[model samples]
Target chain A: MYLVEKLGEKTIELFHSIFEIVQFLLLIFLHLVNPKSYNPAMRMVLTKQIYFTAIGIIPIFILMAIIFGSVVIGVVIYLSTAYSLESEIGSIIITFVVDEFAPFFTALLISLRSGAAINTEIAVMSVNKELNTLKEYKIDIIDYLFLPRIISGIISVTSLSFLFALIMLGSGYLFTFFYMDMDFNTYKYLLLNAIELRDILTLIFKSFAFGFVIMLIPIYSGLKTQNHYTAIPVSVLNGMVRLFVAVFFIEVLSLIIQFF
Target chain B: MCENIALIKAVHENMSISEANTLAVEMLSMIGLQKIAYKRVENCSKDELLLVMFIRALMTKEKSVILKLPSEIIGGLFHIENILKDMRKVNTSKEIFVCDLVSSKAYYKECECHIEESN
Candidate 1:
């Protein structure tokens, strides 16, 4: 009886989560389709979100991307030489680093940083009756707050993923040039040749999907918070964990769609 | 509440920018807050904010308005009564719901319906 109850509870929770995500996505779609959604206030919110989520982290993101690219390239070079698989280096990097790691790491970074902040902020607002205040004013929270954040998240993640991939590719070339005596033309040719149209499309889709999930999960978690201070931390924790899982799920799904 | 007022006046009322400005000026003048009309809410006093919220809800022309009056405003019952009187002049048909603490029940003696909840 106890085991059955636990399973039922878990299943109910899962369904609730799916329902919330689908409802949020519908709200986002409605906000986008409605021309009135793009008011001056929403524009201000979008700009702020983009600044915080993307622009603020550029320096650290670049540094991390360079380090990651160099490490991956170093390993690939050593392994390829040992196994006499030098010809496959470009394909490995393109498939694993550019297509997968760029979006995955970008989502992970954003989930840890902005995701936690959004969840906590909204949770606190809910607890403090701020959301109720907005409601009393007849302000649609979805239009004024959630939509801008969601749109900004998608834009920021997509742009950052592109930047991350470009920087990583450059770093990979630099590492090979300095350590392995590989020519720039050869490295560029190999990478460009290995990258297919499908890979690029898959990367784009993954970034957008991952970005949507990261922002949506946090907002949903925050909204789930009751009018209690204790719920804020719990919401943030749940949002972060769910965000990480969602990002991985998106990455794997995109890869599977691309290959199979 | 101040934000709510601004939003409703600016958006829901379908007032043009200049029209909204004029309405804001008129409302602020009534509350003796014309000087601080354009100032940010963060800088406004509690009373000023509450007054703005009151005026905003009145301007919406909605059939019903529910306001949760802060404890500070409850102590100034006379001021609230005056605002309600002014609101009646502009909108006699509007139903106003003022949710307040049990200690603040005395101020709503003239209200049509009173529902009290105890903790």
Candidate 2:
């Protein structure tokens, strides 16, 4: 009976969180289409958020992508060659790197870096009552704060996922050239023949979904913080954990959709 | 400093940045603190903070302004008159009310503004 009660409590808590997220998502989407939400201050914040989330991380992101991409692509090539399944190499790379790994990996890196920062920033702002100051002045928080961050998250993930995929493909060629004695034309022809419009669409859709939740979850969790300084860290921790879970959940859902 | 003061008007009223900025500077000059126009909040003295808060209060569309516990912002009973003088220099027509403790009533004795004491 005690175990049943605990399970019921946990289940109710989960639904409550989901209901809150959906409500917040609806609120954001409504403001997103409202012309007035993109006032001068919001435009300024959007530009700053894009610069901070996407541009600032580019140099480091590129280096990490090259290092990580080379290893993953190199292993894919090496394993295919060892099994004498080199004819299937293009399809394998397309399936693993293009359709799945790139977007998933990019989302994880961004959630770790920018997601945590945003969560903490919002949490601190809430505790300090800076948001209250905005409220008293009739400035909309959704327009001024939440929308810009969420929009930037979507832009960053979609663009960076494509960038990551490109770098990985480039690194794939290097591995095939030096280690597998494959030429550039053969590799290019292989990938082109294996690629399809659907694969590209899936990548785009998956990135958009991933990006939306990454920022949305954190901002929601941050706002859930109690009106105390001690609540800030707890809010961030919960936000980050929820962010990772949402990332994996999206990835799995995409996989299921692809299967059907 | 100017952005903080102009933010509400700029955001709420959809006023252009330059227009809001111009208004903020004019308000600062009215209070004789135009030189600190670009200074950050932390760099300003207590009196500057109080004056800036006063300007922000005026930025709202409301006709009357309330200064709840002015001593908390300006830091003492001794400087209340000077703060009141700074408030009067600004060209706003908004009515200003100074709410303070009965014990601090002596501090505003020399000022021309009206004071209401609450039990």
Q: Return the clash pairs for model 2, or none.
A: none
- Give candidate 2 regions above 4 Å deviation: A1-12, B32-36
Worst ten in a row by lDDT for model 2 chain A: A38-47
TM-score of chain A of 1: 0.93
User: Can you list each candidate's DockQ?
Assistant: 0.18, 0.70
TM-scores for all predictions:
0.78, 0.92
The alpha-carbon lDDT assigned to residue A19 of candidate 1 equals: 88
Best by TM-score: 2
Clashes of 2: 0
Cα lDDT tens digits for candidate 2, B21-117: 8899999999899988899977999999889988998999999998888888767979788889989999989999888889898999999887666
Docking class of 1: incorrect
**Model 1: lDDT to the true structure:** 0.79
| Candidate 2 chain B lowest-lDDT run of ten | B110-119
